[model samples]
Target: MSPSKPTSRQFEMQLEIAAPRGAVWSAISSDTELRRWFAPDAKVVPRVGGEILWRWGDLHAWPQVIEIWEPGSRLRTRYDSSIVDGEGGKLPLFLDFFLEGEGGRTTLRLVHSGFGPEATFDEEYDGISRGWPVELRSLRLYLERHAGLDRRLAWCTTTIDLAPAEAWERLTGEEGLAAGSALDALTEGDPFRFTTPAGDVFEGLALCCESRAFSGVATSHGDGFLRIAVEKCGGEHQVWLWLAAYGPAGPGLDELEARWSTMLERLFSASGSMSAGV
Candidate 1:
């Protein structure tokens, strides 16, 4: 029998955002605009051979150099630390962005490439494929509704003692949202607005609700975005939550963290499954 063809290492994603080309370009090019939704700390030098960086509060940093910068049209960047080979040497990666617009809407295309045949490379590629769509949804939401707004960040993660499918259901369901201190049901392309018991009101457009996760944009006080996902590993379920609230100031992080932590416990309690931190 012939050997099977090797799996392709490159991936591409397209997002049509409800904004003009200029707006979409800024969302991708400007650091100020990026921090509102994309990453907590972002910097783009706006010139070929300049820098493009994403730093998440000292947790980790991704640094790249710009290769092509065409305003409102295209961008390409190269990162030296994109992959780590088994010999501990760094491999190169490239990211290309293309934008086109008509009728007040912009289509953004992202191409992420530079993976080798190593097992480690395949794992990285899979993780990025799952993550890019969610990140693009956030970019669209920020530009369409929350442009020019600042943001405060809050994130909570927990490992639940339930299966991935079950956890996904409860998290996307109305009751599950309520457990997360959010009182709303999510519907794709529909308005999602709710107030938690803590008196925090969040409003946004529901982007996607699938078997794996639920994601949406914020329309409330600031340009906010959220995504919740469930992954199954080693006979257990892990749920992760990411929330970015737009504005110079908002709810305290301690309170928001506590609320989400409580929500996770409540979710697992309903199924009589005790959770432990991952």
Candidate 2:
């Protein structure tokens, strides 16, 4: 009997953004800005059938032709390249993007296909899985630092009253307090383990922390802020809390707020009896 021909496979990457469709469309469709995050050297022609190329030094990426372009709503493309398979054979590729807007949020979905049967889907998936987070972060930073750029993410803020020393204790000390709730414990350098009330655990990093401020970045939760200040009531200490959550507008905001508030209250209650050490 004759051997069967190899079958093609598919891959995908997706993210729900807090910003509007127009904002995301501008960032992704613009050649100059897209290069800042998506690639070191990238160029795109927005019209249908136009070509998009991205390269960095000796590493050449697959060429993609615009398949569908619906302004802020959707953009799809087909990859015209030879991706090496495990057995040293080349395979064709196809990719697509689906963008949907709901109220004040947007959902970005990416689908890549045409991975021949011999292709290593796991390898490709792993690389893209790790790379997207960094790219998304770069995207967030770009939109934020640029004054005229629209903010696509939502913000949450709260205040905690404590002394500088006490605030530090609640954040860093292990007093079985709930402050440790929202706070993930740093294991190596900034690396930390994050856990949610729903029992979902994520690996993250404490990007910055000091007597007066703290900041962290989590893969599942994005970024957060905790700042300390002298209380207006004199001699007392206070902490300002802030967090940014990505994806479409959903129940996540209220849930995050509740968890954060509970954690803060626990932290305060636990550290309340401790005397100022700073």
Candidate 3:
């Protein structure tokens, strides 16, 4: 008897942006533009058989092999086998980008396909499902609002053994990010305001609120974007806080990073003895 064919799963999303086609193309296919919002560092060789690198600091560098490159229209890539999840991964996981734009506004579609239906693929599958929304929204924010400016970013991430919901509660606790009950009364697209434990106030339209995630504009930070997500990886809940500020006052991101990092550690880590940050 012949062996069974592996089943596959995928994710798809679309966006409408107030930017030109060339700009959107560069944002996805160019290494320089990708570094602004997608990841801390990136490298792209924009052709079939070439490679793209998605780097997270000095630790993780995810690589993909380009399979199709159509300049401003479409690009497709397959996963590089070296980074497969443990031992049971089926190769050829693909990411496809399709763009159609005219005049000053453009529509972009993303399809991430070729995932296996096995437990080994669970961690990465979940990670990508949670991560891409944050990255893509950062892209839209860059093109529509902060285009052509160097982005200043402050990011903090920590992992706790707790479930995502529990970790999220601690993240929004009175002693932490401290979002008020006013947010609970707000709905998507509704104007909202809240203050953090650090005495920072933010006012913006609500964009997202989930048991494990929260996102909205940070109008006070030079009209910047703020996102917090709790991701589950290999049974551990990882909380990530990312802030992107544009214009002259980018919030001294390094200072903010140090501050938030200490906050997360004290709130989530085994020891509450870490030093206080900015």
Candidate 4:
């Protein structure tokens, strides 16, 4: 074997998107274009050997360098950062995007590799595997639906005083998402829709669904992407909710944030009273 590949270290995925190769290329390589669907803030120089910077507010910044560039055909970038290793050491991660187009359709293939050995395998692989599909769908929505429009982004985090497992239960419970109720009947590429108690409908293609997280394209609103994830830190479980609107109007960011905050508070409040047998 060629230096025996680490288990799940390299992930390759391809999807056909309803857009031209140029559109797909711009969505991935252009800094301002990426902000609409990829990162909250992006700065990139398109040529090979150029520096690319992506940021999610003050929470994280992944600085990458363009390794290869062929415009609408192929592009490769490398990220060397201590953030992924989590030990103040740099780890190299590569992201390759290849595109082939026929008429108005483009096949986009992504190769993400360079994850460290088994010592850091699960933590890195698990997170990226669950995230890529949703991100790809977001890309599709951006290129196919909102090619030249601006987007409104909303992000929020809610911390529950319960363990990860317990908080996960409530999130997927009947009163919460109850994803299992609909998940069993849904399959990949199939239409997935869920109506919240407050009458908001979340519709999309059924993407990734696991015990701790769920993500999909929000078809109810064109060019929208939604991810709801719960991760445990210390004694508390934090629920992260991220949604982006590529459309020009409606569902303002302030209103979206308030809605999510109220929903989280209600879930924890109800769970608390039930624990006290109220």
The C-alpha lDDT values of all candidates are: 0.72, 0.51, 0.76, 0.73
Candidate 4 residue spans exceeding 4 A from truth: 1-8, 81-89, 159-162, 174-180, 183-185, 231-237, 265-278
Ten-residue stretch with the least lDDT total in model 2? 225-234
Q: Which candidate should be chosen as best, given lDDT against the real structure?
A: 3
Q: Could you arrange the candidates by lDDT from highest to lowest?
A: 3, 4, 1, 2
lDDT (Cα, tens digit) per residue for candidate 2, span 24-72? 7777777775654455467899899998777542333646788888888
Candidate 4 per-residue lDDT, tens place, 1-278, comes to: 57866444688899999998888999998988988888788998879899889876654587999999998999899987333556767767899999998789999999999776565455566567766877887788778778888777667666566777777766766677655446544556677777766666778876666667766677776637777778543234567777777655435666666666676667876443211100
Q: What is residue 268's positional error in candidate 2, in angstroms?
A: 48
Root-mean-square deviation (CA) per prediction: 5.5, 16.4, 3.9, 5.6
What is the lDDT for 76 in model 4?
A: 94
- TM-score, per-candidate, Cα-based: 0.72, 0.47, 0.86, 0.80
What tens digits encode model 1's per-residue C-alpha lDDT throughout 188-232? 777776665556566777777655776776656455676677754
Q: Write the per-residue lDDT of candidate 3 for residues 1-278, one digit (tens) a residue.
A: 99987797788888898999999999999888887767778899878899999886643588988989998899998884324655778466789999998999989999988777877666677677766766677798889988878777887777667766777777877877887445545555777666777666767766666556777777767778787777664455567787778887585778777878877887888822222211
For TM-score, the strongest prediction is 3
Against the true structure, candidate 1 has what lDDT? 0.72
Of 1 and 3, which scores higher on TM-score? Answer: 3
